[model samples]
Target: MRWPAKLPAGTLNRSIMSAMDVFPTLAEAAGVEIDSPFELNGRSLWKALRDGKREPRKDWLMFASETPIRGHFNVTAFNDEWKLVQEIDQGLLGADVRTHLFQIEPDPNEHNNVAAAHPDVVEEIGEAIHRWRMLYPVSGTRHELVPPPGWRAPKDWAGYPVAVGDLQDEPAPGMPPPFALPTLDWQHGEAGRLIYDCEPYAFLGGGLCK
Candidate 1:
């Protein structure tokens, strides 16, 4: 990965940008115009590269880092300093469905959960996320996006069924087996069809569906 000698060495921006930016950036570089009604979600880095600035061209950048189809449904909104991680989906225990705020300058690792300390920042960023979602409403049914009970990963062809509960309680191979069979309370009506609900289910503090 050798950078061209003609381009100067410098950090472009601290804000996050998606790979989706490439299309428009290349279009701009080629002197192509985007149709009026069509718009690109990312800004071109050409100007920033030409100027060698650390600041982002836009005041803020918003995008979903993970979608429900992949596994987790989360949206992130960030500016130069603050990053807000909004959990649009809920996990099995509904623990993952909460707002998390971090100061990018100090907490680049995003280990700290400052949503409790700065309620105002949470609300502000939350509203921004809401506005962004409103502008570009997510397509497809919400139910199919939500994960099912005890669904940790995409269903595999291997017949190893994953149980969602106190795994610690599963007895050792040498130990005496339990008398009863394990039961799972899955959504009854949504057997073959996808259920589209943006609500989180917290049955035993597991499950990542929203």
Candidate 2:
């Protein structure tokens, strides 16, 4: 909480919050107007911070990736009570996904596998995750942890790094342009491909090639 903003101190809020909430919360606190084409994923927590009490979680479903880094993803979906985790191996093909479920409110450490006991919950959450994932544009975000045969960081992070605005719009070294994409088989040839066999139906014919 910002000191000048007068947000309360020493507040224990049980509300489940995602990093995404920071944007909306801070923007509202700063009195910044937000204009978006669609509804935002997060909400302002300014009220809860002021009250310093257990805040009701407004967001019911949240998706996560980049646990510590990209390529290897420990994707999690959860609400206030139930938490679902998928250990994804972002290797070459990246098809396998191991799911783990826990009643987060009770077992925050996630010691037990309650998935078998709660088939309905698993199906419900899993289906929601699938639908949410389907919203991805399919133009990017390929999972690849195994470094290529020969590759090294171009520059050190503490040294030189390209900003998003300074980055080139051109595709990577061997990436094909959009016009030529429809004819190519993304599965075999493309360097940037999403997890194997996981692409949506539109991606089959390179219609949604990254």
Candidate 3:
């Protein structure tokens, strides 16, 4: 991301951002307007970066990070000062789940479990993560320890189940006519048949299709 004409050279920044920030950041940096049906989970960091400022990003006080890890779900919420962790959590188990807290700025290595010391913080982040997780559609993906019986990985690209010919050559049933491809695309914007039409909601939040 070298742009000597704009940003300073060889500098350190402790700004916290997520993978979701990339699109808006690059779009803004490239001077593009984002017109879409849903709001973006991440805002552009270009201004802060160019001006060498330490302005916290929108919703910087808290963020919920959830992903599948180690055959289970790794859920966490963090701010500049604190991070709350719930490892191997699938959200099915109620009170059985245990939480761990850390003053991340001081304990970057996470060598201490300050959950008992900061029950209030734990509860705050716990509720945040819960609300965030619950926002996903009911039919969203679950943490599967392993594929179901008889499921086998494709040995090669040629053997992939959804090969080129397996797809429809024509647009979806109610899609616009072939002559309107470009117009249809403009209307749809970034949303397409990708991920069965939900866009990146499972991770970045915000479903496609207004």
Candidate 4:
């Protein structure tokens, strides 16, 4: 489906598209080469979404580039095929990050563990968490937003922090340790924070770090 033209000013959403599917659509619409999958930095994309720095372009396609942090994604009208879309980098702290995508099905049994407070709130939280995972792969370790012994929820669930601890059977060679998922507590108004004591994993993509 095409993205809503009237979404909130800076809202971000995730989509599941294969390279074969998105490439031609972008090519036909924008006359740009989508012949190959391009490498992108997760941190740069994240910051772009976090801050509203979108640029409108012709060919119904938009592109944004960040220096030394090359990466790109796509967007399209709700009904049209996905088009190559790029977000402007905001130079946020987590710049140059890479992400993995995963699936998250709902679990009724795990309802008690969430601090949604209200049923609707719980559902919203669940969707957010699920989307987060779908967009980025978990490090296998669950991270918590609340620091140890001081469990406080973040403000507006703005940041859903997850934990990553030392785990074996890495996904890629030289992969960093996985972090745990962060908890979302709406009551305390505490935005989640991902706690990783070590350096972030290096992202691989075209013109990514060059």
The best candidate in terms of lDDT: 2
The worst-scoring run of ten residues by lDDT in candidate 3 lies at: 144-153
**TM-score: model 1 vs. ground truth:** 0.54
Q: Encode model 2's per-residue lDDT on 60-134: one tens digit a residue.
A: 564556532224465567887888887775556655678899998789999998999998988888887777667
Error in Å for residue 116 of model 3 = 0.8
Higher-scoring candidate on lDDT, 1 or 2:
2
Query: What tens-digit string does per-residue lDDT give for candidate 1 at 33-130?
Result: 87778666667765555456553534557766554233357788887678998776544455355788998879989999889999998898888888
RMSD (Å) of each candidate, 1 decimal: 10.6, 12.8, 16.2, 21.3
In model 1, the runs with Cα more than 4 Å from the true position are 1-15, 57-59, 65-72, 88-97, 137-210
What TM-score does each of the candidates earn? 0.54, 0.58, 0.59, 0.16
Can you give the lDDT of residue 183 in candidate 3? 42
Model 2, residue 165: C-alpha shift (Å): 37
Between candidates 2 and 4, the one scoring higher on lDDT is 2
> How much RMSD separates candidate 1 from the native structure?
10.6
Q: CA lDDT of each candidate?
A: 0.57, 0.61, 0.60, 0.29
Query: TM-score winner among the candidates?
Result: 3
Compared with the true structure, what per-residue lDDT tens digits does model 3 show for residues 1-210?
688888778966667767887899899999999999999987787877877776564352333344322124456677667888776534334434668899977899999999999899888888877787687522354543332211223335474555333444554444446565444333333442332222232323423333
The full ranking of all candidates by lDDT, starting with the best, is 2, 3, 1, 4
Decreasing TM-score order of the candidates: 3, 2, 1, 4
Off by over 4 Å in 2: 58-61, 64-73, 88-94, 137-139, 142-147, 151-210
